[model samples]
Target: MKRALLGADDLFPTGGEAPPWPGRLVELDGSRLLVRDTPATAPGAEPALYVHGLGGSSTNWTDLAGLLAGRLEGQAIDLPGFGRSEPARRYTIAAFADRVIRWIEHSGRGPVHLFGNSLGGAISVRVAGLRPDLVRTLTLVSPALPFLDPRRSSQSRALPLLAIPRGDRLATRLLTRVTPEQMADQIIDSCFADPRRVSEMRRLEAVEEIRIRYELAHYIPAYLSSLRGLVSCFLRAYLPGAGSLWRIASRITAPTLVIGGRQDQLVDIRVAPQAARVIPDSRLLILDGVGHVAQMEVPRVVARAAVAMLDEVSRPDAERPPRPSRAVRVGVAAAKPGSAQVAPA
Candidate 1:
């Protein structure tokens, strides 16, 4: 596959020229979801759906979606209880996937280029697996899948603990003690390899977002519930044949891109290669010095890679012949080096 190169300016666009993120509340399954529809610069581009990570809103895709505007008509959704959306009736991954499926079916916009991060990744996996007709392609960034690695940070360790009776209350109290700016700082520290690299404008935006999220009456409850749901997903020891994420991945025929950040503190980097291996028509891209949120932290890098994948698959099947049943590794990092191979257990 050909590698796409993006200019430095593409990564850091000037103010005002940044792509527009127009917000709309779309109802799916009787629940309102805040979505950002970014029109493509080119006419009649295919539709793409972006799902943000846990606690992330549609705004998280602002930069990355803009960069892909030339090739895709992008829409980023605020999952139930996040951003401007209301709390969901249920908080399971299946529940979240069902809402997305309903929206796509109702809108007659099936088989879109689907992109997801963290918790959204797991949700997208279920969608692509169960409703393969709804996903044209799949892109996952630092997906929070189950793994047996013991080298986890406190943030991850705290997730399963939220299931305890008083866990949510204790966590809420600790979070409430911090100012919004401090909360933003904490998030940046955990999600970015270099928090200082975040532009001043972006920093201000994040601080304001933190403030708004903190003010939401249902925010903490929703966050805790989602975290608990994710923990349950991780704990399920499904057999290899059925009801497993790897099994779900194998059923997906869509061309897939599994992206991982070398410095990601949440999801283990090794999961990327494993996902690529399981998904038949998949490729892996590991970005150096990036963290959990590659779309937000390194939009240009991710945009180029995504566009490259689209370009490869867009060609005639005759010209772009399918390879053997093995997954491909499509990218390498310059800032830091790590094994891109799927390591054995």
Candidate 2:
């Protein structure tokens, strides 16, 4: 298949000179946006649904969106409190999954393929497990599973979200002063294995949006509470907490593709084994030197793998592709210097 691409800045054309978007405001859950795209503009002709991590809006997937859009129609959401989406009253994993279901029902795009990064990955897994009927297949990039080794600094930030009483309100007050650059930096550090590849422009965009988020909500307390609940799903044991999605992984019957960055500090290398063990009919790919946000860190490689996985899922049972080996699965997706071939050499 031929690769589809819009040179760099071309993919993200919002407002002043942004690329023409596929659809705008299909629906508004409060203030957040439900964005959609079609392959008419994208190159690959691969249909997909993407989910971003915490504190991220659909914009986070801007470039990735355009890249994937080339293959097929694509839709991405700004989960409550993260992007243009307004925070819900409660931000639990199940609640987020509900919103995903709502979008699916509302869009009449049932059985769509799923892809997610970091916290988004956690939510994707939950949605697939809970609503297997809705997903054609599951693809996770640096899914935010709990750290076998705790991230002290990050843990401090996430703790209140899970355990502190009314901590969301306090978190908002504390983080309101957070700049988008700071937000971007933290995410880059936490999510990418090799953040150096993150362009200056991507950092700036994230910086701007993070600042905008603080000003959007009027019910600061509730928003904070809901934000906490949403993150708690990712921060609690196994990132979504124990018996949540991690436990659900073993029961997932979906054809799954799991990718992790060797550079990801948020969710470590070991988690891949856990995912491989639990997910039935699954393939695991670990991109070394890549971080939690492998998709962004190396869009081409990640996007290619994604399209291949989805395309495989879409094939007839007789044409399904073979599984990938652990050797082919490990390493940095973008920065590494080798092909990940699955067949015997």
- Clash counts for the predictions, in order: 1, 32
State the number of backbone clashes in model 1: 1
Candidate 2 on 126-174: residue-level lDDT in tens? 8888888888878777676554455522534455554668665766776
Report the Cα lDDT for candidate 2. Answer: 0.61
Cα lDDT of model 1 by residue, 194-279, tens digit: 66556656666777877887778788878888877777676663544466676787788888888888888878888877777777
- Please give the range of 10 consecutive residues that has the lowest summed lDDT in model 2: 336-345
Q: List the residue pairs that clash in candidate 1.
A: 111-134
Candidate with maximal lDDT: 1
Q: Could you tell me the lDDT of residue 229 within candidate 1?
A: 78
Candidate 1 has its poorest 10 consecutive residues by lDDT at 336-345
As a whole number from 0 to 100, the lDDT of residue 6 in candidate 1 is 30
Score candidate 2 by TM-score against the native.
Answer: 0.77
